[model samples]
Target: MGKRSRWLLWMVVAVGVVGVVATGSNGGAGEGEGKGKVLEPVVTRIAFGSCANQSAPQPIWNAIIDFDPQVFIWLGDNVYGDTKRPFKLFGKERTFGPWKNAPRFIPSSPKELESRYLKAKSNPGYSRLRDTTQRSRWLLWMVVAVGVVGVVATGSNGGAGEGEGKGKVLEPVVTRIAFGSCANQSAPQPIWNAIIDFDPQVFIWLGDNVYGDTKRPFKLFGKERTFGPWKNAPRFIPSSPKELESRYLKAKSNPGYSRLRHTTQVIGTWDDHDYGLNDAGKEFGGKITNQKLLLDFLDEPQDSPRRKQEGVYTSYMFGPVGRQIKVILLDTRYHRDPLRSDGSVLGSSQWTWLEKELNGPKSAITIIGSSVQVISNLSATTRPLFSLESWGRFPKERNRLFKLIADTKREGVFFISGDVHFGEISRYDCATGYPLYDVTASGLTQAVEKAVPHVFSLIVRFVAWLTPTTMRVISKNCRFRSCTYGQPNFGAIEIDWSTAPVTLKLEVKDIVGYPVTGVKFSLVELQSRGSVPSVKAGEHRRHCSLEVNLRWMIKYRLAILFYCSVSALLLAMIGLAYAATLAFRLFLHKCKLD
Candidate 1:
């Protein structure tokens, strides 16, 4: 062949090699789809997050290590960078993954950033998390491995007067199992090394990675801006670039994170704060446009559930074990209706997709990472401060969803989330008699939102109390459990897919201490002891009496449509009220009202 021909051949080989590495060897999002014989009874442990502060001393890493989770998920509230570009990464129907085009991999220029991720990873306490075994060979392999992608670089060159020594993009995203440790050790670093050290396969970002002036008051460009004086005491504020960079760097620098870099995988979806406000969406000025950018930062796949569907709700599976872990990353703020019209948590398009995913014949273990509280109630406070920014407001939608889960007989439905500045687990019964348990984890760094004054927050507490009784109605064959948890803490779920009855364990670890450890609960026995079940939440909204009838109606087209319409209408009413209140308050509080 001529010299030109040889060059072309070489070029093609190089391109092919890059493509393979980029898609997989470099680490792909969907690794479970691998050709390897998927092990049976897939053992999986998922670490769920809700509210993580963009601050130092996020000790929950200790709890996560103690749990030895296989996967970690960010349910939302990752940080508080409200002003940062591409702010609305969470609370949307359609979501893309992280942005790859950003200058994340470049090392030389990002000296400060490199130091940040590297030093955070190198924390001596997390050494055990990185070096899981004592053997020299294991230690050698871990130490020698290089070129891990878990290290992310963010910030800008200070063109817009951000004028710190330098500015990074300040994103709350990671796409690997582990990356660095002590990448850049800073002064007075929270004795993170003094506590339990552990590493996670994937560090899933829950949300609020940046605050973005969420709790503070004021309006700029027709958008909510930071104005202090809390609606509730110690109200949540948006995250600044420094805070965002700090949180990401600290985690990235930790050696335990290297697993996310080389050995394990990472994946996540967001809730609010990652956007700009607590319950914001596309119509919030240019927020929708920012949503697209957020997706890029997240590295979400276009063909994935969130991309193909309406909301950020998606799924992922790892290992075989005849188990599939479906992660429905529910966006609470994006397309939701205001509180006046019954309010919606998810828009119509996304709702349809959600039903299908739930009913689809696919997996045994279904884990839904909800950004907001699904079962907890907030009525004691007058402002609805504890109100239904969650599922409680959209009763119709929740009912429809419950019906779907029950009708579909979807088993092991675990709802994990953050945002309440607290944590709790509540088991909700389904029409099919199976129970859905929701676990809330908030404030990996910051403190939980305190009890607001009045009946609104009180009402929420009351409703929460009734959950066990309410769930008991559906769980005649099975029983449900419930409880409240607080932070600085993190949550985890462990699954034993080996035997006839699968075992699951839930944990909440306190990260404020040196040798961190916290609460734990294990469901060792598969209470149902039956085959995998399926149910569509919409089918049973008609108040069907017989279980057989509920299943039978699922086939009929009209029933589902009616349920959808009803849910939409209910959601709209509540949303309208909530929006009206906020709008009216803007006028009333300003002394401009007639």
Candidate 2:
């Protein structure tokens, strides 16, 4: 072996290492398939976190990658750059330096915000970890004492199994999911690092992704406004869709959001703040324009009906039958009926579509995401109190939803909601079916100063009713399972398939990713209680027949009475007209036939 031979060996070793890092051993996307193939993971490990404050040091980034989530979810409040200010350079010297900073400094402006996103994209940590066509892969490892190792499965084109006992295709699994909401850009956001450590396969944005362009004060400005302003930053209220788009551009560029964008797949819907208003609904003027911008920001499919439709509600199914999971995102803002409207909360078309979905097919677990609380009411004291924005406001619709679940006996169905700046769990155990659980997590950055108090006084309740916008700032009293208020927190839902019946674990974690409170439910517990006792056919028929006979008799009497009265009136009127005509004819005969 000479010097040249030794040099050749060294070069070979260097190239091999580079290939491993660049292409990844888990299986690069479209290795053999060719260009532009849709890629996914065989097993999804979602890391969900929201309420991002761009200026804050996101220590959570360190923790996020430690957990090694396959996807990152932005559950609303991704940024807090709210302002009516334009992209103009007003106080550049004040915020930046003698050296100019273009985008990030003006956190709320649209045009200037582009630079912020560019800056975020340039982050070395995010660039290195971001998912790419070359590095797309899932490295499955059993959690060990010190680390995770031991390859389980690996392939390209969304985790195709490579020769498992003579080439068996492995189905994708949705194992871990995390979510949260309500972030402020100026606030301290170390919790993101903790979320990274938790390591999820996918993240779900529960809404309030940003506190953009809101009139509400950052802290308590007045008794009427509970939610604070966007980190008390300079206001940047977008008047047009283009300006709003600019705001979105700035939000996407936030380092935390930017890093997550590269690291994993993200999906989300909007709350009032993100939708360009506080507690907005169907009457929102710029809904269509704002919706278009939102879809573009979310990278929604060009062919999706959401483009043509009025709302943003959508559903997605993952995995095969036995292990399948369905995620349903309900658009609570767009096309929502007015608070006290006679129609419905979900509107007519959406209501019909929802019913079809619930009755159509069954998934191992179904998670319904609402931007506001669904099961819990604001009142926990004596008289029932209600939230103007929650499902409680529309009792008719809420009961209809409950009845639908009971009628269809839908199983493994639970709700996840955000907003209200807190986290809690509530349950509605139906007599005819299994317990329905609603787990709400909120505020990745902003938390309430105090929980909404349980109201017992009638005077207070009446005042609240007259001024619904000024409802007391009260957090739910933990009765069902657990509750956490007045803290920046996130939520997690984990599904385990290692047993006969699948189990789901719901958790609410603080900014540091510590589980403040949690609850677990098994498939058996979510299912209907052994087909509601069947009604006897004979007895049911007898009761139905008797009711029908009674109704028919009453209807028969009413019909006859109406007919007789109408007939007598008509006869009298006709006779009177005839007599008058005869008298007129005698009088007219003396006059003219004209």
Candidate 3:
């Protein structure tokens, strides 16, 4: 071959090696296994969402049903019963000087809230979703039972009988769980069909199960601002438990939701709205009564200890043996302290319970569900400008939780949260022994993207970009530059057991049940003794910065290498082309001289 041809061949080989290295480094675990290796099967699938308006057309259910998940979770805001309307004192409308009767908002009456829940329950699409899930569960149970009986009978005789051994049941071991929060009972919820399509076996409610608290703005006066001469002048006044109870009833009565209750295993905890107020905590007067109402909506057993508990925090274990999964649902609203107060979030009793849950029997995967963002500190990203409710509000408590996990040396633990009305995935590696991931799926219906006008989308995008959490995963699925998806979305967790190291696929899906952004990691990566360093609380910030930067580099290292290699190849080709052209010209000149 000509020297130029040989050079070209070498360049091609070099590029090929670079491409292989990049792909191999980022490829999923257990790739290129030897032939005939017995692979594990996917054992569980969980799905979740938040911020849905019950009264709205919930068309997303159809897409969810298509996913055919075995479990569904409600993160909260199952409905919007407590809402603001034009404020009136006695018989006259109140006016705030200059503003001229600027439609002050107040919480709806208990009776009114209940009626709204009832309306949400009546949504045909939601009802269909519930029915479909129930039927799927029934069929699954029957299949499992038959399969078990067949296997037992076949083995009873010691030796294979005539046709007994031939009886085979093709039951799948996969389990699917779905969850979401922040639904408005009065808004168009067109996402129910998509959720129903997923056919999840279990559903979890994270929080905002209902909008039971409405904002009560204060009026600006000559020297002081006030809540329009109201007796309490409160920013947000929670309705009595009676009103909350009514709303719960209305939500429970939702035909789609009701049907879902009968078929799929539904479980969840509460956030501020469903807890009877917005950003309320242990200070709320009616917390005791509201707690009961919330439990009743969940159909908690009359004799269960949860009913007698002060808070709704609870946990559950599913599957069996090595493939088991433990789900811990936290009540962030009931006993939470005011934001920035440095007080407790789970409270003393709940904290103790949590420790036990973490230290108890081991599960292949441990999922901790919170009603608010746990790992993402939005305040840190958007400090001074504004703050969002999150675990970061109580720095002490957040640290304590992180400490508990480290102390216990637990493995396979991650977090799922809601109430932010957007979907994103975050990972923190400083405090924990391994990279801790938090998948947040919010806005079942009430999404920030829809709430904002198209004209101001650019402004919102700019804000998102400016206020990115250190943990937010900047992936290709991001609709905005910030990697935050502000649309009707839900979270799905699929555990693939077939791989040597179990694979966990975490996703934040769109209105149509399509994944917009997600992350896939092997279960072994969540081991307590993984490569991540355990940083002391004092050294958190310094280490956090270094780790975050390192993580970014590690995550995109492949892309970086690929791009660099291509650029080099192009440069080399350009140089080679120039040299060949010069050499040809010299040859022609020499020939003319001869």
Give the per-residue lDDT digits (tens) of candidate 1, residues 85-117: 343334442133473333222233455545555
Estimated TM-score per prediction?
A: 0.49, 0.56, 0.64
Model 1 spans with C-alpha error above 4 angstroms = 1-126, 129-198, 214-264, 301-310, 380-388, 449-483, 512-594
Across 1-594, the per-residue lDDT of candidate 3 in tens digits comes to 112222322333333333333443434547654322222222365668777787678888756755555567889887876665654553455544454554655578899888878877777655665565555555544444444444445554346567746434332344667788887656666565466556666678898887777656556553434444444455676876777777777776654565455456678898888888777888888778877877778767677788888888988877645788889999887778877678889888999999999999998899999999888877654434456888877778888998999888888999999999888888888777788888898978767777889888776666676554557788775666787888888888888888898898888888788887888889998987644564554343422543223344443443455568799999999999999999999999999999
Those runs of model 3 whose alpha carbons end farther than 4 Å from true positions after fitting are 1-174, 217-232, 530-543, 546-594
Candidate 1 TM-score to native: 0.49
Q: Which is the winner by TM-score between candidate 1 and candidate 2? A: 2
Q: How high is the CA lDDT of each candidate model?
A: 0.47, 0.61, 0.72
Among these predicted structures, which one has the highest TM-score?
3
Give the Å shift of residue 40 in candidate 1: 30
lDDT of 2 by residue, 1-594 (tens): 112222232333333333323433335545644232222324457778886655556656546655656667779755555533334445643334355455433345685466556655454345444542123332221111001111212332354345532212333477888887776544556666556556665677777776655453444564444444424443334346665677677666565555455444467788887787777788788888888877776767677788899888888776655788888888888878776674466888887888888887888888888888877655221122233367866767777887887776678888888897766666665323676777878888766532334443333333333321111222343322224445678888888899767788888887777776677767888877765433343332211112112333332443454467789999999999999999999889968855
lDDT: the better of candidates 1 and 3: 3
Residue 283's lDDT in candidate 1: 46
